[model samples]
Target: MALLSLRGLVKRFGDTVALDHLDLDVAPGEFLTLLGGSGSGKSTLLRVVAGFETAESGAVLLEGRDIAAVPPHARPLNMMFQSYALFPHLSVAGNVAYGLKRDDVPRAERDRRVAEALALVRLQGFERRLPYRLSGGQKQRVALARALVKRPRLLLLDEPLGALDANLRERTGFELRALQRETGAAFIMVTHDQNEALALADRVAVLEAGRLVQAGPPRAVYERPATRFVAGFLGGANVLEGQPDGAGGFDCPGLAATLRAEAPVDRGTAACALRPERITLRPSPLAGANASQGVVEEVAFRGDDSLLLVRAAGGALLRVGHAEEDGAPPPRGSTVHLAWEAAAVVPLRG
Candidate 1:
């Protein structure tokens, strides 16, 4: 059995379903991220797990025991919201120690735990500082320390890094993952940022319209998305429709030759999800199993890489990524050849 499991989880607000029979499992000590756009039920799932919102039906199981009936405070879990919710009146250490004091822990023990939590987040000496006195990142650390001080069985993070600037969010993502590893605790985070989910999650659950469209490691979900929604959500994808043959190939028209079935081919109106980065662009025409000839429509400088928007002979626009340099990229209106490995094209169902 998994460490935490939600079976047939369903939540509704009047006629609208916030979660529709959502099923998920988090392994012991795993960092699982529920990723999706707004209104995709990611936050709803986190709220349900944190006991802030109750599901209309289903069960929450921890270590094979049902926790659906347990009160929020009685459960061994802690939630960190996007707002941090640190008390402005209390110092960092005081905020961290509040939970322990409420539970009637000894003064010395409470202080020890608070110090340790602060140290875990590299804010040991900043305990006496007020929330408003700290930087955004520092304040977030204090919130995290407060949550960690309790040593909860599960940590619920709702848009944990959304409040930080881009650079700080990236830095804190690494720290959050490291903290989870060192503490060996289960973390379930909700976020709308696809890159953040891909970077920090051990496994990602992509939710859409209250349903789990796909769930797997970051690579699996990105490279082999199970649904059209999952394919488009992760990043840029060149979606193509083609039929598959028995011997393992799709005789696709206007896209060079047949694409290998890529194992486990689904029949009828199947789609291929190809990432822009996976496709290689060359000046000369190339012949291969998975190659498309197109004319470069635009070349965009994206700092480290160039984004090429090419119009294929089939009239479909293909996005390709290539390294950037001082010299001009493949000139606009130049014929370019695109190729990718047979396995690069992922088969997708509705």
Candidate 2:
């Protein structure tokens, strides 16, 4: 059974609807990422679950029980903010003990639990350090320790590593995943970074214009985007317009080949999506599902890889990635062949 569920959740700020009848579910022990741009309602959704924000209409259920009227202090959830939100004057141990002290937990148990939480975050030896005395990653772990010390059933992380440097953020992403696995807590995180969502989440919920565009396992959402917005937002994609040409093939003015679509079509137009990396570029013309002719317009060397911008025969700009120049890459204004399997191209509707 799912550990948490949201039904028709609606939230509005004056004329702006932050969440439009949003429905979501989090499985037990799964790490779910709510991914969206600013004002896309991800943080609002997380705040609603944390009891920091209330929905204008709808219900929030934890373990099949409604908690609509529950106050922030009484809700069985804890939120870790992006800013760390640690007390400047308090020691790490004090920050972790604040919640326990508020609940008036017994002295011995509170001390024991605080120590255990600190140990879990690998800050056991630095319990006496203040927030300003530690690095960004250490400060983040302290914030996490403070939240986990509460022993909440649902853990809400509001851009948990957003404040860290790129290097630290990458390292902490792995650490956070390991921590979630060790704790077996249902972690719901909010973030706009696509790579972070893909790397850390068990499932990703993508939101756009206050509504969920796609929600699935990271690879499923990446490889099989349900809409143009999702396809373009999750990563880069080459979109092309074409019509079915019978027998698992699609044909248009400039494209002629077989493409994998769910059903047969009749005189209707459809769009196809292909990731940049899915495309294979060849210096010479190729045959079958792996071929298309285009003139390379831009070539950029990005250290480990090269990005090629090609103007396809159909007048669409296609991006392709090449790791380590294999012989001579097509230069600017030079024609090249691009190829890939029919299944690699995802057809998008509307």
Candidate 3:
């Protein structure tokens, strides 16, 4: 059995459904991320698992036992909130030791666990400092240490890195993932940030309107999204509608051209979701590739890469990403060609 499992999970507030018959499983020591937009039920699912919210009908099983009836503090799980809920008056060590003290654990054992937790989060020497004295990242570490001090079987993170700056969030992602592996605990984090989810998760569950649209490893979900919502939510996708030409290519009427598709197309109003990064751009169309001619509409600089929005045939706006080697992009209004390999196009049901 999986370390954590949610079966037929459903939650509602009056007429609105927060979660809808969702089923998910987290493997032991796996880092699973529930990714979705606000009101997409990611937080509600976390709250349910944390025992802060009760689902209308479902089973939340931990280690093969249903935990639906357990109280929040009684469950062998810990939650770290986005606010980093560390007590301002207590020193870092004191904050981490609070749980042990509440449970009437021995003083020596409490101190030992507190020290180990602090070390795990790389805040070993900062235990003497108060939350107010630490940087935002440091304070977050204290919160994490406090949660880890108990050595919970599963860690629930609700936007844990949302409070940190971009650089600190990136750094903390590495720390959180490392600490999870070190402690051998399952980590389920909730976030709307697609990049963060893809970066930290062993598997990502994309929720939409209280339903799980897709769930898989980051690459699988991003490269082969199951639904239109999943395709857009995971990352940028140029969705195109077309009919199969029976030669493993699409007679795409939208783009006014035929494009290569690796798989034999399924019948129906099918579409192709192409990743912008997979499309190459140049001054002219390639000889043996699926190519389109367009005029550069906009050039977006994103540090390591640049996004070129090209207005192609049939006035379709196509996005293309290329390495920003010289950090210079072709000016708007310049004609360009965008091409992708046959294997690059992902066929999807419309």
Local distance difference test values of all predictions, in order: 0.86, 0.85, 0.86
Off by over 4 Å in 2: 245-248, 252-269, 287-290, 325-328
Cα miss at 189, model 3 (Å)? 0.9
Worst 10 residues of 3 by lDDT: 281-290
Q: Which ten residues in a row have the lowest lDDT in candidate 1?
A: 260-269
The alpha-carbon deviation from the true structure for residue 334 of candidate 1, after best TM-score superposition, in angstroms, is 1.8
TM agreement with the true structure for every prediction: 0.93, 0.93, 0.95
TM-score of structure candidate 1: 0.93
Clashing pairs in 3: none
State the displacement of the C-alpha of residue 295, model 3, in Å, after optimal TM-score superposition: 1.2
**Best-to-worst lDDT order:** 3, 1, 2
lDDT of 3 by residue, 103-220 (tens): 9999989988888888788886887888878988888888898888899889999999898889989988988888888999899999878899999989999999899888999998
lDDT string for model 1 (1-350, tens) is 69899999999989999999999999989999998878989888888887889999999998898888888877888999899999899999999998899899999899889989998999968878888899989988998998899998789998889889999999999999999999999999998888999999999999999999889999988888888888887897877766776556665664645666457554653777788888887667666567778888999989898999988877778888887653567889988888888778887768
Model 2 per-residue lDDT tens digits across residues 115-173: 99999988878978888999988999999999989887779999998889999899999
The Cα error of candidate 2 at residue 324, in Å, is 1.6
lDDT of 3 at 229: 72
Q: Candidate 1's C-alpha lDDT? A: 0.86
Model 2: what TM-score? 0.93
